[model samples]
Target: MQLSNIAHGPEIRDEAVAFCLWAPLHQRVTLKIEKRGQWQMKRLADGWHRVEIPGARPGDLYTFILPNGLEVPDPASRFQPNDVHGPSEIIDPTFAWRTEPWNGRPWEEMVIYEMHLGAFTEAGTFLAAIEKLEHLRRLGITAIQLMPLSDFPGRYGWGYDGVLSYAPDSSYGRPEDLRSLVDAAHGCGISVFLDVVYNHFGPDGNYLPHYAPIFSDTHKTPWGRGLNFDGAGSRFVRDFIIENAIYWIREFRMDGLRLDAVHAIRDDSHPHILCELAERVREAVSERPIHLIAENEDNNADLLARDAQGRARQFTAQWNDDIHHVLHIAATGETFGYYRDYAGDGAKIGRALAEGFVFQGEHMPYRGKTRGRPSTGLPPTAFVSFIQNHDQIGNRAMGDRMNASHPIEAIKAIAAIYLLAPQIPMLFMGEEWGSTDPFPFFCDLADELNETIRAGRKEELSRLPGFDVNDALDPICESTFRQAKLQWRGAIHNEPFVEYYRLLLSLRRKWIVPCLADARGHSAKYDSDGRLVCVTWKMGRSILHLMANLSGEAVDTTVPNRKDIILSQGDIAPDRLGPWAVLWSLAQE
Candidate 1:
């Protein structure tokens, strides 16, 4: 079995490198450390090679040598010399950590708040984000899921194009800034989850081919060629990736890693890279519980299934885009993308509650096949559901405002789905009080990689209707990211919106007893005509009914039992109102 090791180089000394390279077909592998003069190496066996390069360090460059004459550097190196075009550089993990040992909240108790740190603030540095941890904590969010911080080309991006796996993006401050962000977040009882892009590397900074065989033309993803996880010389490559996953949990003190686009990871292995990575992180965090959440669009419940003895080889959970599908269908009444299969979105919402999956193995007209399998027995905590996320917002032509499209009343209905439902609720940053920000897909690429990114973004958006190719590269100006920042002023002043979000978050934190039961009892009931759908939070004493008025006009709504007014986005908060008129009512038998 390949193990993790520490390697180093010059410019920085004794840098810790958890190195791995693809040399599977090769019986022997040699680690090479190159510096001022000639490079030196030591041969290793088991199709694996590892050694701590003592003198070599961060800013110093090095690569690996396989029996096949392939040379690569520590795949887990935080920094790469030559800007991802050259060998990997070591990064020391001994930076001062002030955050004491802190155990994170339960999966069911967690309210994940997703943010793109680069666009979350004006400065857009990790240090800048650190100043905002207390804000998220006060918002009733238990976890902060950050978009990718790994080094990508240029100043801005969606972070899916990261090339350097180990280092934090220079635009977001150095590695130390990221460490400070996580530590500070921990201090305020907020667990950090970095959305990691493992599917592919950025076009500009990517030069993995010169190091080892980590890319394969055989299996192409929607973005590009899939990672080389099972091919020849892939053992080391797999190790490099799996170790990088663990590096964040063990070293960076992150509570979890949100694996970006797991569906794009095509590996033909008996024990796939995903399984290996989960187990590796499990072992790495044996002393503390850490999460390895994958963002898989594959509506498969087996994606979260565990092995015997309750050891999860799969992901902790995935982003439930299906929830967005159902909510969008319910609110906007559109059936595009994977939402074509939803017969009744209100029922789909109910299915999300009862079964813990929205796309439950139904014939999906969008994919022309049965899409997700039924997850009847899984915990509601197995899925993170949200009405708006980066993908939903950024995929638009001008990135139209989410709250702008739907009525303020209907917007509250959508948020109530996640907060009231059993599934783990996630809020896109600025979603609480509805900050007017359009998170458009903007990236800064090197001059050489400009055409590559342009063509790639254009082709990807081409499938969508009426997508403008000219909009792919919107010019990565400061205004690009500036437009995405949250307007806390609006949230603070608007007592209604402020109280609305606070009420939802506080309500979720107060009554949603993850301990009472799993997501087994909740059932969604609604129709195609958009009349009424209900979210029933089943409890031992009282079952809560979350009713939504799909149409523009008020419609007569009914629940399982009597109701009372709890909250609403309409003109007046209902209190001691008639049965049908009560916007939010807590009732009993």
Candidate 2:
């Protein structure tokens, strides 16, 4: 279990602790311990400053003073006690094991439930989230994918604009509290995953540009300058990002990482940063199964390719937005923006179900260019399917859930289809009980920056239908953050929706999971007649079938005859399928 020297931060020696800082731009660097004497750091040749402090223990607050007299926290700080701009706290990484060593569950058994820590509960703390683990376990969720925990500015945000890559947000309790949450989850037989952003740092509180060459001059992303992955001073930059991924998996004991928007990561280096990060993480942990999921809009199948042994070569899976787009349009008929590429195309849904992507090297009118590569070579497990997620719900003009405006029957029909499909299934927070609580994009930053965000959000969503500027919530408002919190009391009355999800998950575990390990790529055949989508997958010796009519009128479609009926929503007759009807069955191949 060798670790990388790129693990930059305070490292506790036998008696004294060694602190290292990578400041290439600075010739003189000083380490300042709060209420203690300041020490001059020795400069190393590779742009790193080193200092050793005797009698320095955990809980000591420290910061680095550059030659220009500006202070900055450690880029790899383990914890921040007082937000992003505050001092970094020394944390003892030791934790007592309450459970036996968790080897982690197989990827085939993953039923992911994505959640935001701040909005997951009223308390919005890691300890508070531990209280709800039992509820998720009972709901048959094998994996809990936590939204980003990296420290961001102010009180609340989606965790995407995180400046401190290593520190968990101080707003959500201490580092030990997060460890307890993960320990408790592992004790309950649930794998914990973390969402991580490495493409670019947040807009505010990022002091890297002042001290280090972290951004590339040639490349730019949607969020402005991209990280220096293939630039002149990129070796250390790539090492920094790769080590962050390793630190999360090795130190925090996270079972996996959901890389946010990997398409934005531009690297021309051989053995790209994505590849190197995956390889290093796999090398660091071998006792447990470590899954790496990506949110790549490019629909690049090469990232999710498998070896000859049927194991993933790089990433384990990706968030399949194609299936989500087609399903959303079928349910709500809203075809604005990217949804236009999938609107009125029932075959796109079939392709997303059987194959992974709908636009596999095909022209997408929305992007005005060809999008995605061939994805049919990948297994269905390589894609994760979901009806609603944070981006899908929060990115809307009103931040509304599908259940907020669509019919219950329509939502249930899509749920039955994806929940039973061969691909992995993920649920947004409070989605199991048909929660309509709006998870609008909320953030707290400087007043000037907040105004910019407010205006930007309004301008971006103003073109969409039914968007009213007067009704739009200010993203900077504290009340906007509170509005996104989950209301647990609403679930008490939504028992039917809860039961439906539980039943679908239970059926998946019993009927689908057992055959998934042997599931192969290009083993599914699908057909669609505008609205009626029928797909069949060859899972081992069993044949799994799905018939869905996403139209308002009943369709005269022949239903496949299978004695082992898994589940059915709406009317399913011999020759006529009711509006919004979905039927799933299994039979001998």
Candidate 3:
């Protein structure tokens, strides 16, 4: 359980290399070295095959050969220098870490900036991304959440389809390059978090089924068969995932991991995989702050709650879709699909601001079921609220961002509310300055699979009311990927919006962040007209008020204590707000 010597990958030593694997079903297993022949491995006591090569050293390529003469890449491969279908490479984990004794920033102090490495810069490599760390630091970002780096079978992807769980994508630079990027981020006082997929493997190049019963035929996910967690032979499968969680934090020195989707990880056992993972990750860190964030569509507030005996559950924070959905509806007034429930009537958005989730035991027509549980007593920091994230943008038919459909003032108002809210805020890459580039859905699949995915996307969009299937970009096109790249100069040209963001973030850091430690100190109220919502925060008599107007016309309403106004946008009158305006103020008394 310590994962010190019990790791399941190729371990390199000075004189001899020990390779360990969990292949209980196979009676005979061989370690096939590239161009160096093969060696039979002896089965160990705990259903793992073990082999030690005397002359093996770092940078060696190896694969596990099963009894059926099928050579498969290591399920726990650390470096897939070749594609996912090729042999795994041995990586020298030794790096001169400059930030020794690096205690990461506290969870409450994080203002995360979610980025896609390939689209973040023109170079689109790990080393190239290092140059932008200073720019992020200057923007007051405390953490950088990299989209999944695990190697998938493609030239590029949103990174959700990663099959080689341990290997960083070879399309990006080498393993050392990723380490260098982390090192540089640490040097800039930015904590690095990796987004890891645990629910299901990719469609193409997935060889897990060849080695063991890792997938459950009984349970399925949107991608395919759900991973084996509760069924027979599940202990090893669960261990595989838990070990991966530990590997990222301990080996990569990542401050935390953003678990891709917990709803898909089906487990009905006592002390669920989510709870076990949290416990194990805490034990592995041994006091260093390592955050675990979950992306759960269920809006289960208990994921962030403490149990009856006062033990932590699920994760440190959950992706609050309620917040994003309300903001989206308030901005665009698009009432189709899931957005139908969030009609921008002010009650739903107000509830989300007050208690973290709006659908707390309420019937949701979109899914035709009652959704969410009450989260009133939980800490505000337990939820991660974002105006725009990768899924909300890239998963769209056309991969359009928040600015694509909403007015500039409306976008600014929503961004202001999210940043100044008590919960942790996350900004999508290029969102600060309203980049015009569309973060369209793009992936690299085989020729046949590519055609199938393209057709499937068109069909999915055809069902949606407002979507124009013809406008959707080809997911397999090279031009689609290039079109999503950020134009950094957009930040310069959109200076007003950039300054608005910088000012609100600075104000939140100075005033709002201090109040987030106490959950009971925050409250929200919305006008009956469904156009204005005011969120108030109090930390030992220090009161901060944020008022936002979601209407399309000016509102003749009294300013909520404008004397101590710190930040104001759009038409700011003494007792009125212009269309799509916002005000952040503090109580003088």
Query: What digit string (tens of lDDT, one per residue) describes model 3 on residues 512-571?
Result: 776665444444444446877776655446666767788898888778655688778788
Question: Against the unseen true structure, what C-alpha lDDT does each candidate score?
Answer: 0.68, 0.90, 0.83
Better of 1 and 2 by TM-score: 2
Against the true structure, candidate 1 reaches a TM-score of 0.85
lDDT of 2 by residue, 1-589 (tens): 2334645889987798899988889898999999887999999877889999999989999999998889999988888888889889998999886867789999999999999999999999999999999988988999999999999999999999999899999999998898999999999999999999999999888888888899999889988999999987788888888888988998889999999999999999887899999998999888889999999999999999899888999999999999999999999988877888798768889999999899999999878899999988788999999999999998876788999988988999999989999999999999999999999999998777977898889887775655676688788888888999999987788988888999999999999998897786338989999989989898778888888999899999777764777887899898989999998888875
TM-score of each: 0.85, 0.98, 0.95
Model 1 spans with C-alpha error above 4 angstroms: 1-39, 43-74, 80-90, 306-313, 336-345, 466-479, 485-489, 493-495, 514-530, 537-542, 559-589
Per-residue alpha-carbon lDDT of candidate 1 for residues 1-589, written as tens digits (9 for 90 to 100): 5554532122243444334443445555566656443333333554344444444445555666655676554545576534444566555567777766677755667788899887788778889888777777777888899998877777678788888787777777767678888888888888889889888877665655654577875878877788888887676567678777877887788888999888888888768778778877887787766777877777778888755534345677778887777777766666654556664535666666556666677776767777778776565667788888899888775665568776666677777666766677888888887776788778777777666655666776776655575665353555766676666676676657756777788877766653335344333333323455555554445556666655555554343233355555443322222212224445444
Predicted structure with the largest TM-score when compared to the true one: 2
Q: For model 3, what is the alpha-carbon lDDT of residue 235? A: 81
**Global CA lDDT computed for model 3:** 0.83
Q: Order the candidates by lDDT, highest first — what do you get?
A: 2, 3, 1
Best by lDDT: 2
Badly placed stretches (over 4 Å) of model 3 are: 1-5, 307-312, 520-528
Cα misplacement distance, residue 113 of candidate 3 (Å)? 0.7
